[model samples]
Target: MTTTSPLRSEDRGNASVTRLSPFQPLTDEQQRLVDSIVRFCERHSHDGHAALVMEGDAGTGKSLVLNTAFQRIQSEARDRDSTRSLHGMRNILLVNHPEMIKLYRNIAATIPTLRKKDYERPTSFINAMHKSEQRVDIVFIDEAHLLLTRTDPYNHFRQSNQLEEILKLARIVVLVFDPRQTLKFKGYWDDAHLRTLLAGIPTETISLTEQFRVEANPDVMTWIRALCDGHLLPLPAKQHFDFRIYDDAARMYDDICQRNDACGQSRILATYDFPYTLNGEDHFVQTGSFHLRWDRNQPTHPLPWAERPESIDEVGSVYTVQGFDLNYAGVILGPSMSYDKVTDRVVFHPDRYEDRAAFSGGGRITDTPRAQCQVMANALFVILTRARQGLYIKAVDPALNERLMLLWKERG
Candidate 1:
């Protein structure tokens, strides 16, 4: 199951520090933000404090930042309460934001002590917390981007929502999120909703804007930032990227793979839409770009594979790789990001693009006009930055991939 995911040892009990170095030391702004966040946690480590938001661009080191800060927070919390059901808040469960309350429910279901249908909505959530007495010092949301807004049809229950329930239960809550990586309004994302959830507390929020992923100068990085920021007009309002286009994905991949064998590890990618569309055949994952594959298609599998599997490790969606990282990542922009010049606009098959979306129009935007650009930017952010030194992009559409070709051509 090593598919698109990073190597996960069966017992992930052993913490793995990021081997990658910082692109640049945290900017004064980032340091100030981290200082404030760290101090807030220090004060609240004993338990009970206002909520905090860890805001940043995707792959800007927010995870690393939060993780490092959390270690200190846990250490401080333990100093205060030795018997708090956690050696260092071991009772605390860091859940993804989108599936916030639902995640709590799912974990509760597994425990025999907790009742599955005990209650619904926030009431259910609070009741469960009360039953478990998860009165720890803090509650953390790891992938806060998944946290949805109220407009989502999939999420009907308000009180049971992740944000709402966390407010109700935890003495202190720390949520790390990048609106850039946010999915959709499964919940509500309006200012009104934000105020209601985080309204009162003086939010010690900061945006991590520096990119440690792509090794580029300010000029080139600016273009990448513009694309992701949705400042690039007519591009679905997302942080776009600069890349090298390839008419032949397979040939380019073969060359990269060969080069990788010569130097070090390298990867090949393709969208589910044309999984193996590289040489012109559906040889990769049966699923296209949208469908995330963790370890092949098999659900139950080993964690850190003794030996890397065959094609399973070769192709996967961006989602599967989220959390996990690698030495080098190569991306093939499938037909998904293809903009038909004839149509004069990009056309994305809803089923292909990644689910994450940036906030743009005042309403819910599907995977077509808005979803593709934002998700692709995020994917690019992750893929490019994962490699310590290099990033390779092979976009199929001659038109779309050409934007990337400029970087290479200019280099020459």
Candidate 2:
């Protein structure tokens, strides 16, 4: 159960933030996508406001493809003897997640050509572009769903839409988007919205369907996806993967610690049902004898929350582990999620959900109750997919716990 993923990047232990190196070995499909991206960039380097939308589910190697293509495009830009298609281009990479920003910046440190400054948050990149009145050749945005769609003065993002602003500044904008990963109301996005944004603008969409993170088989993946979509199906048997349900959260934490000791990058994750704040105080997530605190916001911290060894005692939320890979993940489905016997489906309780920021739309998102429920479901989907080798779950709701245990027993 402590087995780490065999495909984990060799450099992960060193950086503790990255799942793959920029030049890490790529599968044939990944390489082809990277090549196509480079060609797209080259062809549209001088074109006006063109976009390449790369859409995929969680763990589809979207970030890897973006990084590899970026490196190649930067190489082409620097090569004097080449066609100079991207020569002297000013390209930047944007990600709204702080943990992802840390990962990419760490990855940039090892490469002489890739500057850490080139990797930035979308808000920062957009603000800098406006202040300088500068236009870039290509802009690569990872986790584009996290981009703010409406003006948020708190984040200093005054734009109505992030992608629209980036398109205005860059000739070719490449974005990696997953609608399922959109967690906050401020950054809400979907295919229709994306199409509307790119209405008159030239664009191409590429979808990646392969599952690259989990070691589980197709049946296991289907079960997980179904559960995330609010349907609780019969739990499937594991194949080449470890999946289990724990009645005692304390026991689950013990196993996660053991996995972390045996292999690195193992941690416990939970839904945002518990109350927490950034007022420099401790908030513990208690379940029976299991006691842990939520991952703190450490803006100056170098390593990601899950990467820090001390984080084993802390519970991570979707924000911390979304783009990172874990050797093993012990997930706590909080009280906000429950199993309804009448419907035989997983139900979300917006009143019980504690992530207030995710619900505060400031008039950007309508249907407040449904939007809050979707936020909870989206958080579950993200935490459920973080595990590479194994997934262990401990449900807080009594009815849900009972139902999950019954389903686990059926996994014969």
Which one is best on lDDT?
Answer: 2
lDDT of 2 by residue, 1-412 (tens): 2222222222236433344577787888888899899888878877777899998888888998889899888777777777767888889999999988888888888887788888988888888889999988899999998888888899898879998888888888899988888898888888899999889988988877788888888887798889988898887676668899999888888788777777868888889989998899989888887877788889789977867777776789898988888889999999999999999988999888888888776485657778777777888999999888999999999999999999888876
- Which candidate leads in TM-score? 2
Q: Model 1: per-residue lDDT, tens digit, 181-212?
A: 44444432333455667776656666677765
Report lDDT (CA) for all predictions. 0.48, 0.84
Write down the RMSD of all candidates, one decimal each.
Answer: 8.9, 3.6
- Estimate the overall C-alpha local distance difference test score of candidate 1: 0.48
> Cα deviation of 370 in candidate 1 (Å)?
4.3
Model 2 scores worst on lDDT over the 10 consecutive residues at 2-11
Clashing pairs in 2: none
TM-score of each: 0.64, 0.95
